[model samples]
Target: MIDLTSIYHRAADNYCYLFDEETLHIRIRTKRDNVLEIVLLYGDQYEIVDHQWITSLQPLEKIGSDSLFDYWQVAIKAEHKRIRYGFILKNTEQEMTLTEKGFFSFIPEDSGFFFCFPYMHKSDVFSSPDWVQQTIWYQIFPERFRNGDPLLNPAHTVEWGQEEPSLTNFFGGDFQGIIDSLDYLQDLGINGIYLTPIFLANSNHKYDTIDYFTIDPQFGNINLLKKLVEECHNRGIRVMLDAVFNHCSVEFLPFQDVLDKGEKSLYKDWFHIHKFPLKDGDTINYETFGFYEYMPKLNTANEEVKQYLLKAAAYWIAECQIDGWRLDVANEIDHQFWRDFRTTVKAIKPDLFILGEVWHDSVSWLRGDQFDSVMNYPFLHKSLQFFSYDIISAHQFTEDLTTILHSYSDNINQVLFNILGSHDTPRVLNECRFRKERVRLLFTFLFTFPGTPCIYYGDEIGLDGGNDPGCRKCMPWQEEQQDLELKDYIKTLISIRKETSLLTSKGTLYFLPAVNNCLAYYKQKDNQVVFVLINNSDTEIDYVLPFSLSGKKINLLLTQQEYAAESDELSVTLAPYESNILSFYI
Candidate 1:
């Protein structure tokens, strides 16, 4: 047995290692160590593979102080399978064991290493496409968005002892509804639309999926969806449908059949069943998620079920021409399924983006598998939690924002959807007591900060609601009662975001300063440099510009307001929740 207890060391400067059955690639951290060669050994006989050097590390940083090195990566094919493997330094004639780690770490057979790191084994189970990195998505709850076609509305009364509902209960929003509003979306500069699950489901919110293949009758049939996709494609917009693979409704055909006939049912193997409730037919004794009772969890471990889901996903991409998917409760489902699903989906279309619904750190999902990005709830949650005390100081906000940025992985940090509030939470304007100035600043940060920004529907018109059902209210089309100032402010911001290359194009973010209840940050890409400053203090505060960033600080937006930068200090007075954009050449 390979000794699992030993902490084998690579060279002190070696930072990266990639090994499959055949080859082992090692990367040196510093440029000085780039000349070293690697040797793999087994049973006193050694196999040597020459190192092919890639470019040196772009920016050099001291690691501890022992060694200096550079990167060396090579692809190799091994002669025989070796259990006990170690590497030797070519120049120094020194050897030490290299234990496996990371997403591809191999497990020792006897020690139950697989059980200990079950999730890690499940980490590389999927491969998401690269386009998800560039998507600026907008999530819309169909019931609340708009009502286009009235004919597709389900009858108020159902047949054979079915529950009946009024038209108000079902707002009659359909596929055509979204189709009619493409111009509005295009004008707003949204690239993608992430509609909630439109599958055949019972609830107004389609979390309870009844059929995997069919579109909900209330939301029009499959044909309508295809048409909608075509129209959206014509307008240069991509559509991403929500996939609730975690659970199915009790009324779902499979679940209902299982409930009707205990073990004898054909779909018995699909769910995790032990016993059913005696009073209300047979209730399956299966493990379910924490959300609600009606939503029964699917057995993704079953290969047949896995294939069916993959087929359905492929059907949407191939048949409906969807550009991506927003996976619901992705963490709760089987890891292998995600891996297989990603592979299968990518095989169908390499550009299909998969966004997972992970509320916390979703690094494992975003690492070139399963998902390209997550909902970014961590950013919104922390930001809102800090500002819930009725006021957010600029320094506190900046610190909190920077902490979130650094915590995330490089891929997710840049592509994350920075949303103020979604259908799941209270509206920001309502929570901030209808303070339009603060709302304006928050939206400004959302559009300017790292990652793709999303705007919750009706937020631009100052819609206020506290929680779910209320927060997910219908679109207020009453033009006379709208917040014109807030709407105009949002329009201005949106226009600027679409027109300005610095705001739209991604760049390296650098923190400038956070002093006297004011914060400053800069984004640089190519020749464009945009400096964002936010003042959260009650009284007017003067900002002293950094000496290094002096000369030609032109006010990009507020041109009427005069500011001066001379002799190392740029003094400008800022009102409460006032923000400014200072454009200059680097």
Candidate 2:
């Protein structure tokens, strides 16, 4: 019997949204494999025939299926830019019509029974910067990328890559260091650089920001920061600075004033204080960033605090000409504050990328009024679980990924900030137990996957470390210490991704069935169809592709080798941990 409750559809939000100004994507979900077919009953709500509404029928194609549901999508164009739609679903045992009002046994000609899209409002579309989809980002922790100017080394700064990374250690990596390393990043084929906090602060990491206006003296002055952005821009690299608005250091002037004057201070509302007269005891009296005594959470709801932070957000873009912002602890802040922040920043530069640091589901923040995208930690966890830890099978991993893909509109998914590792997590190499081959497969999948991909500063060189302070290791500048082969492999992937529109947001990239513990997916754009097959298991596997490549020209992207498909079904033999990207045209 059909699961009547499982059939789902809405004419707005993630289920239905604008792909572009002219195209609207409407989606419906049903019990997995239950519905034999979905017929879209759609027409402009105002269009009528003899005092009754007239509609057209279009069959919806199944775009994806996860464990519990089948997802179907159809892009529609309404002649009057308005639509009334409903689904006619047929199962093996029964057929039903679903509308906004209720289920029906027969088609409803009245517009009142259908889901309504009043108008195609341009503002409703979730639009990010166009260039963000193609961007390959590199995240740099300013204290450890390189030591270009030894003159600016902080007191007690250790020699580069000397001691193991620690919470308190500083290796004197400054903006000039990054400026000097532009050629290296350029060679790696990265177009965007996400630099962690460089603001004046007492700690080595600078996450506890003391002054948002000034660049840390240890890093560089404002002029040098400008020069770094200028230098990066010259090399066709975009620069995005970290903005830590959720909390700030105790040493920040406003916080200091509140500390000294308590209830009498004019800036007492700058931070969340419980019953004044702050204490240093274990039981602190104020809200902070996850119980950290030094980082007091800001009172974003306070009017003065809101304007103060919003001004600082505008300052960098207006002054340094930066390309984006990566908000720290973004989920903790009030939504209206971010809404205002978006309006303020985008007014200055419409193309600026605004990415939020959200570890969990973030559909609430990805609307056009807020962030352009979020740090896709779900993608990180799943990738590490499959490739690094070998805990999940390829079949299970693909099911998990498909669920996430259907949760957001394609526009939001394409601009997502997909990260493998970061300052807060273990290095990808460390997660893979230093297996170079596992890292290779992981990198291959990341570059081939949709959304904007980011590389942690030293990930290219096979840097290995555990979480937090350990993950913040110094970048090895010496050629002998670097993993040259891994770097080249990642570089090649970036180059191929830039050249192939199939890998970008232009086309579809979905998983094929998992076979013999191997993962496979294809990217199809027009006559060009591309497949990426990876042998996840340790043992060599003779994998069979789901689609036939008979009588077509096939080209392996990584190796540029050409082949002619002799049979309809293609059988590919892959060694342990080996992956290949094969492409063919009709």
Candidate 3:
């Protein structure tokens, strides 16, 4: 008789299997102190009876306080379908592969089992009909925005001299500030605001979440968030909060309970632990990548933890009525957790915008299961690498850009989030060595290029900063008196981007050969066509159009400059940092 239920469990170094009395449920159990590692299920036995053992990574040292973990899950519904799988572990000198004699086998190449988690239904989600298909988004870090509320200033605990220039430190900035600055953001022509983590966090940056249910008091109360949402909606702006699900603060109730109770904590199952790091009842395990022990990582592998955070996210969406989320450090967490997390958030708020923070290509996330978008760090990194690193050749630079865009699947490519500068990096102006022209050329490319464009606060006014605290500097309201031209130029770019469908539309492109160091590309969408050219070289170079010219020619919408295209190739020139956009009607 083929059993209908089966489970495969792997301990710190062993495997356990369990079968239901009715043979309809298979249970796999493995425990370390108080934590459980893997619990998987199978619908039928005959479906996947013959399978070999594969590979598995050595269990990570319990970074939190618990020893339990659930890395992946498999659920088969059909009665006769069988899937083979196994586990292989290798670290340094010791390597071993083992097969369990229970239910369906785990296979590394099989993606079907990986996508088993629940997903937000398409209809209920808030994605535009073609949201990800054709989108150019702009991200706004709220605190540095306009200060709308004088009541919501951050309380300074440490002096500037005492404050370590590290991410662990916090600077007070809030939601009221975002509302007061809507006009400034609107001037930049962004469709959405992917604000950083705004949940009730203990720190100023808000990554160390204290309470998922409430908005941070420093950032303003929940009421302030509602007002911001209403105002943003009033102006056709979509708002997405930052979701830092990978961990919680040490002050969080679950983690606190673990610390208080030691080994007998009821919430001990919520974290991963091999052996308690505490020697004399002192909390030894601080967190994943933290200098201090206060910020603890949440065990996403736990179902209750998953459900709790998902519900918290849903509550905010329903109560506050925000659009979606920007997941923090998405790559470090388990893929299944995000899959289920995405499903839960979408189920609560369809059309919800989900973006992830990954420093490189996240195509694996876009496989129709996890995130709607990811911070286009890959593009941002490459662009900065080209200008700041100067190690890459022009050919290599262009090729890298092309490769990134081409790498994404169709659906993922549409909602790609690109940025010039963000809260985490040096402002683009400084990254370009304070050269206004190179900056201008970059702006031309940024606004013209595909994917959503995110502008870190103060980038428009040419704010200069090197890294973290510097990047998070106060807005240059006072300096605008001297840099009005740069401000106006950004406003113009925003205006043109909003008005032109060709610039915003999603379509294929043809790269025109470089004129000297000038590179150009044509963005065509049906009857609308736009030609963008940027000259980064020291001297002006004449550029000739490569496409057919049998059409009505017009001036560039942003600069209001006109050019005639008589032959298939037309002569156009750009000076240092000079860029132009020529529109044509076919």
Candidate 4:
């Protein structure tokens, strides 16, 4: 008997989203091992022939399965640019039709009972810059990356990389520093750079923006920034600046006017002030970023505020020719503001990448109108829990990973801001408990997994630090102080990924049955297949491929060695914490 409770589908959101202006993708979930197949019956609700609705039939392919459910998806298009769809699912015993209303013994003739996709408007299509999917990103914290020009350093500036980092101190990292290291970044195969907030601010971290129109004096002036961007563009590198529009430093002139004049201030409505006289004892008069008093949240709904911020957004892109913007606290601001933000920025440069700094499930923000993609924290959580803390088994890790993949559509997944660590979080090495083997294993997955991957400034050199203040350590410049071996290893991985298109968004991903503390997966693009296997256990284990590899030519990607499979079943051995990538033709 088919389990009715196991079936699930939705007409909108990730379950159904536009792949392009003309193509639409629909997905469904069923209980694991309970359903044998799913066939889709779809048609335009209005068109009819011979007193019957015109219809089309197609089979849904099984894309992935978790511990409890299997995911199936199909892409389709309606001649009328709209569709009403239903499913016919089969089991060992019987088959039944599933519509939006309920299950039936036969396919519903009335379109009212089916799921409806109103229209596929060209404007509704979820589109983003295509170049982002192919680029590898590196993130740099300006205050700590390097000190290229000591002339502008604060009088209290300290020696580079000699002491611990603090919230208040400065080290004079600037645009010249990044410009000076463009060759090094190019040498490491990085084509995109994400710089934290660099606007004029009072704090060393620069998250509290005092002015949106000017670059921080300590970092560099407009000329130096334009020069840095020009140099990066010459090297095929893209630049992304952080937008702190969610809040501004308490020192902002408008907020200061509000503070001094209270109810009588002309800019009193610019902020979310609750009561006059600013604050009453412990009660704050206005909202702020978290509980901190220095960072006051802006009323994004205000017309003047929205236009002012949008102008700033377009100015930097036009002036510096920057390629992207990472919006901070994007979810907290009004959705309408972001919709306007997208329209404003895209007008100047249609291909500008707009990324949101959301940390949770961000499906609502990725509907093509608001954001292209958000920071993928779920990936970081699952990876660290499995590899760093050993809180989950390899089997559980694969299930969770598949769940993450199913959480969004393929288009959004391709350009996700996938990072293991950023300036706000603990360094990847610290998360792995200072174990180099585990760190190496984690990074292997980072670069190999789907989506555009990012490396923190000092991560490739084995930088270790704890959370915030600690995670923001200065970048080391001395050759002897860096980990050359690890750097070379990361560089090679980037090179291999760039060389093989299948490893990027060009290939399709599927998780294999994990066995004996070994996790396995593969990507296939046409006849080319690249298989990845990793052993999490201490002792060596033999893993057998689920599908036969009979008479196939396999070339190991880590080391370009060729081998032939002698039998139908190919069993390979993996050493402790070892990972290998194999490429072959089907």
Model 1 per-residue lDDT tens digits across residues 12-67: 11222222224323332223443244443222122223432111112112211112
| CA deviation > 4 Å runs, candidate 3 | 1-138, 157-172, 277-283, 290-292, 479-482, 526-528, 563-568
lDDT (0-100) at residue 499 of candidate 2? 88
> By descending TM-score, how would the candidates be arranged?
2, 4, 1, 3
lDDT of 2 by residue, 174-272 (tens): 988899899899999999999999999999889899998988999989999999999999888999999999999999999999888999999988888
Q: Which ten residues in a row have the lowest lDDT in candidate 1?
A: 111-120
Residue-wise C-alpha lDDT for candidate 4, range 317-419, written one tens digit per residue:
9999999999999999999999999999999999999999999999989988889889898999999999999999988999999888989888888778888
* Candidate 3 TM-score, true structure as reference: 0.73
lDDT of 3 by residue, 1-586 (tens): 2112222344211121111111111112222232233323222222333462332222322111111322222222332323233433333343332344323333344323331212223332223335543344555655554555556666653332233335544434567667777786676666677788777766656778888887777678888889989998898788878888887787788888887887898888786654564334655654453545666677788889989888887898889898878888888788999889888887887788778888886756765578777877788777777655566655556656655654553234446777888877888888988887767767777777776676776777777778876676656456533367877887787677767777666444555545565667887777668888877677877877765675457677666876666666667766676778888866
Scored by TM-score, the top model is 2
Lowest lDDT block of 10, candidate 3: 12-21
Predict model 4's lDDT versus the native.
Answer: 0.89
State TM-scores per candidate.
0.75, 0.98, 0.73, 0.97
Score residue 302 of candidate 4 by CA lDDT.
93
Note the Cα lDDT for every prediction shown. 0.63, 0.89, 0.62, 0.89
lDDT-superior candidate, 1 or 4: 4
Q: Global CA lDDT of candidate 3, please?
A: 0.62
Ranking by lDDT, best first? 2, 4, 1, 3
| Residue 316, model 1, lDDT | 88
